[model samples]
Target: MGANLILVANDEVASDPLQQKLMKATAESSGAEIRFFSLEKTIQIIGRAADRQKIFIVVKTPKDVKVLVDGGVPIDEINVGNMHFAPGKKELTKKVYVDQSDKDDLHYLKTKGINVYIQDVPGDHKTEINF
Candidate 1:
């Protein structure tokens, strides 16, 4: 997306002090303006940034995309990478994991006209995701 701003929207960092520290460290090392914000504030930030920046939002779940689109962010596509394994979740690829909620969220996004795909990294083969 040629994004100039990297917004990390994972709420898990709020509770995990180590994760927050690591995130900050990553930003410092990469020299990227990585902002930690909730999805609600993310919308306002994006609106304010639209005219002056390109944003790449990093989120943990498909629900995050749904929330952004529902709240009026123009997200037309999503590329999923590695995901943590959770109880009751099935592994789709070595890196992709999903539970029923994830499935439903992805289906919802698909119905809303978003192109969903799984590719762990750029230049890797992308598998088109279908509900």
Candidate 2:
């Protein structure tokens, strides 16, 4: 088996510290590579409308992990095999975050032979997807 990859997602401000901490920890413990990607940045990169919601894919690999930290999108729960993630939105934003409950999408990922893991961080930590 290969080394695991961990993806982290969060609000830009709130998630930065935790992502750094997690990166350090992962580097020290698992020798994992961490890649930071912003959902907001992805939106800008993809040239999508900010008002329309987009589902960003954060994948973890043996070499690195992809992260999506967007202030606009609210993510509540994510699942990956034995691991599961649950988190709420910022109190000030009043966003109704929803769980990633799309099995067909997951099934497609499975069909594509991808490995994924999911995690949620509380107020102090940022939630992110892994693959």
Candidate 3:
């Protein structure tokens, strides 16, 4: 595949050695070429090359997707992975939890014509984040 793996995060996340290591490990395990970018930089770079590059964006939260979209990044699809379910948050799936904020952000993304899928693994059947 000619796709590139782009991990999007803020400065705090990009500065963490453990986070960087984990992302690198995951990328290597998946045989993807990985690059890190802050939210703003992600918008800038993806805005420039989204049409030409098969870029997979890994974001920390749904809010990040909203930020990118609000900033004019052309996001046609998004995958919400690693959503750790905890008590009190409504369990959407074994690996996904949602509160009001998550629901709101997801709704916003859907209304903007972005397809959002939530799963630790692709193709797992469950409730979809459809509008």
The local distance difference test score of each candidate is 0.80, 0.37, 0.74
TM-score on alpha carbons, each prediction:
0.86, 0.32, 0.82
Per-residue alpha-carbon lDDT of candidate 3 for residues 38-114, written as tens digits (9 for 90 to 100):
88887777656755567777677888889989988778887776777766678776677877888899999999887
Worst 10 residues of 2 by lDDT: 89-98
Report the error of model 3 at residue 23, Å.
1.3
Off by over 4 Å in 1: 12-18, 29-31, 50-52
Q: Highest lDDT, which number?
A: 1
Instruction: Give one digit per residue, the lDDT tens place, for model 1 in 1-131.
Output: 46666788766754577876787787675556767777787776676775677777788888888898898988878998777798998988888999998999989998989889998877888899986
Prediction 3 global C-alpha lDDT: 0.74
Error of 3 at 20 (Å): 0.7
TM-score of 3: 0.82
Instruction: Supply every candidate's count of residue pairs whose N, Cα or C atoms clash at under 3 angstroms.
Output: 0, 3, 0
lDDT of 1: 0.80
What's the residue-level lDDT of 42 in candidate 3? 76
Error of 3 at 33 (Å): 1.3
Q: Model 2, range 1-131, lDDT digits (tens) per residue?
A: 13243334333522577766756675556454544555455434434424433333343321111222232323333333322334631121122222343344443444444443333322333323331
